[model samples]
Target: MSQTSTAFRGVERLVAGQQTADGAGVRLTRVLTQNLQRRLDPFLMLDAFRNENPDDYIGGFPDHPHRGFETITYMLAGRMRHHDSAGNQGLLGPGGMQWMVAGSGLIHSELPEQESGLMEGFQLWLNLPAADKMMAPNYRDVPSAAIPEYTSASGVHVRVIAGESHGTVGAVQRPVTEPLYLDIHLLAGSRFEQAIPAGHNAFAYVYRGRAEIAGTAVDDRQMAILANDGAAGVVIEAPVDSRLILVAGHPLDEPIAQYGPFVMNTAEQIEQTLRDYRDGKFEAAVVQAL
Candidate 1:
C-alpha cells in the first residue's frame, strides 16, 4: 500500500487546564468542560488525575449518574475499583481503559484500590447525538494486554485505543461519532504524523515533555486545538522526549445541554434524565459482563 503524508492542521489555540475536585473530592485537572470553551461537538470534557499523596486521591469518585453521552476512563498508573448500577464490577489497573455508554443513564462508582502509591489516569467525555441519547447503556473495557501498540524506527511509540494506525486497528468499534484516541510517546528529535478525517475537529493535549505541533510549541499539561480551516492531519516533532494524547472526532453539530454528569441535546431532555434518575431508572441497573 502507498503511504500518504500527514498534512498540516493549523493550531487553533493553546490552553491549559486547572486543578479541580469532583465526585466526592477526587482531585483532577479539568482540561475541557462545557462551560470552559466553545462547543467541541462530539466531545464534552477531559479530566487528568495524577496524584501520589494518599490524601489527595483516596476519596475517589462515589456513585454518580450519567446520561446522553459516553465516559472513557484510561489508567496510566495505579488501580481503580469500579462498580456500577448495571451489575458491572471490576478492577481497572494500569494501561486499562473502560468505555461506558451512558445512553439514557447509569450510576457508577470508582474508588482507589489501595490507600495510594500513585494514581494517574484520564477520563474523557464524548457527546452523543440526539438520536442515540436514549439508547440502552453498555460498556467496553479493554485490558492493557488487549490494546494495540506501535513503535516507529525513530522511537515514536503509540497506543491505539479507538482508531486505526500503521495498518493496526484498535479494539473499540461502532462508535457513533467515529473518533480517534491515541496515547503517543516520542523520543527527542523524533517526528510523528497521523491522518485525520476532513471537517472533523481535532486536538492534542501534551501532558509530558514538549513538542512542536503544526509549527507551534506546546508544553506539558497544555493543549493545541486544531483549526478545521486547514489540512486533514496532525503533525508533531518532539524537541525533547514527550508523551501526549491525541483525539479527534466527527462533530455532531447539534445543540448541547449539560447538568452535572448528565448531558443532552436539550434542557427538556436533561430534565427528563434527572426525573428518570431520581425515579430510580438506574437503581437496579447491574448487568454482568465477563
Candidate 2:
C-alpha cells in the first residue's frame, strides 16, 4: 500500500474517568473532556452524564454568562429545554444539539422538563480565535434528525456533529479549526477504520464497551491522544461492540489563558474579560450575567 495513512506518534492516555458538578451541583462525568489544558489543542472540555433520578440532574445549568467561546450540547436521550438572552429557545431531545457561539457575551439557562426518565448527553466547549472572540453572539440548534450520519459497509457508524472527516461532513458551516467530530459504533466481531487528514491532531475517546485504538487496547472511560502525522492521513481501529468519539482539529498553536467561561491569550485579556462583564462593558442586548 502507498503511504497514505496518517500515523500519530505517542498516545497520551489521560487519567481514568472523573466527575464534576454543574447547575447547582448536579453531577456529571468529565470523560474524554478537559484536555483544553494541554492535549486537545483548540477544544476545551467534554462532559457526559446520564440521569434517571431527578436529583441526578434536576437542577440544570442555571443562567450563566459566557464569552470568547462556543458551547455544543448533544442529547443522547430525554429532553432539554433551553432559553438564552440571544432570544433563542428550543427543546433538545435525543440526538439533538444546541451549538451556541458566545462571542462578546451571552447568558443562557438549560433546564430539564418535568418528565422523569433517563437523560443522557454531552456538552463540549470550543474556543474562538482571538479575532472572532469579540464577535456577535449567535446560536445553531441542530435537531437530532437534522444532523446527518453515514454508516460504512463494515458497520462503522459516523455522525457528523460540527466538522467533517472521512467521507462525511456535518451540516454546520463556519470557520472551524478544521476539525472532525464523529460518534462511532462498531458492531460485534467487527473491525473499523477511518482516515483523518494530515497535520491535524487526533484522539479517540471510548465511551462504551472495549475497543483497540491505534494498536492500543482502550476500554471504556479512557482517552488516547495520537501524535501528529504532519502530512500523512491517519486511520483508527475499532473492535466489536465498541463506541468511540473521534475528534481531530488543527492545533491553534497559540497561548491560552482561561478563566471560568472566558479564554484568551494573555493574563491582561482575562482580567479585561472580567472587568467587561462586571461593568457592563461587553453586555449586548438584555443579557444576564449569572
Candidate 3:
C-alpha cells in the first residue's frame, strides 16, 4: 500500500460533440491536459465516444495507423465492428473490451453496426516501454462474458478491466507495470478500501453518485487523481449509486513524445510516425485510409 493519502485534481468535465475525422462517432468527453497527465501516466488520453444514430455511426473509423502504444476500448452500450491489417475481425458489444497493442505498427478501424441502438464506449491509450515499443503488435478481444465481476466484502461491486485489486483479477494480463483497472459501484454510506502497490499512481473517475476521497468530496461526473507522493491505499466513503473507476499503475520514467494518435520516446520518433503514415508504409491493417 502507498504511504500518503490520495489527493487528486477533480475530474475534468468535457462535452463531446460531433467532429468526425476518420471515425463516425463523436467524442463525448476527453482528458487532455498537463493537469490530467500528472496523475495518469503510462496511460495518456481517455475519450468517451458514442453515436446512437445508425446513420451517424455507419461512417465508422476507416483504416488508420497506430504505433508505439496500446489502445483499449470498453463497450458500454452498443456494438462495434472492428477489422485490422492483421486480419482481425470482431463485433464487440456491451461489456466487451478490445485491447490492441500497436508496437512497431498496426492499422485498424471500428464502425458501429446499423442495428445497434446507442453506441457508447471509452478508448484509453497506454504507452509501451522502449524495449517493447517496437516489438510485434498484439491484440486481445475480451467478450463481456469473459470479463469477471465480483462483490467485495464491503458490498462494492467491481468489474475488473486489467490488473488486480479488491480480490478480483482482471482476466486480461497487462504487459506493462502492475496496473489496476476497476469499475467500482458502491452502496450508500459505504467505505471502500483496497491495497494498491506502494509506488503506483492512482485515481478515481466518478461516473455517478457522490463520494469522498481522503476527506475530499467528489460528486458524480468527476474524476479524482490520487496523490502520487507515495501515499497509502485509497479510502472512499461514498453515497448510494456511486459509480467510479479506480486505476493505479507504476510510473514510466521515460520521456513522452506525443502527436495526434501516436505516442513515442523522442520528437524525431513522433515525426517518423507521421512520416510513415503519409508514406503509406503502415497501411497494412483494415481498408487503407483513402
The digit string of per-residue lDDT tens for model 2 on 207-227 reads 788777556778777777766
How does model 2 score by TM-score? 0.89
Cand. 3 Cα-lDDT:
0.71
Best by TM-score: 1
Candidate 2 wrongly placed segments (more than 4 Å): 1-10, 32-36, 229-234, 281-283, 286-290
**Candidate that would win on lDDT:** 1
- Cα deviation of 58, candidate 3, in Å: 5.0
lDDT of 1: 0.84
Residues 1-290 of candidate 3 have per-residue lDDT tens digits of: 33234542232332122333335444455642434554567777666555666665567787777888888888888888888887778888898998888887878888776575787767777778888887777787889999889887778888998887655679676666566777788998877776666677666767678888777778755567676555457777786668777777777878888776677889999888888788776665332221
The lDDT of each candidate is 0.84, 0.73, 0.71
Model 2 whole-model lDDT (C-alpha atoms): 0.73
**Candidate 2 clashing pairs, residues 3+ apart or interchain:** 5-233, 6-233, 6-234
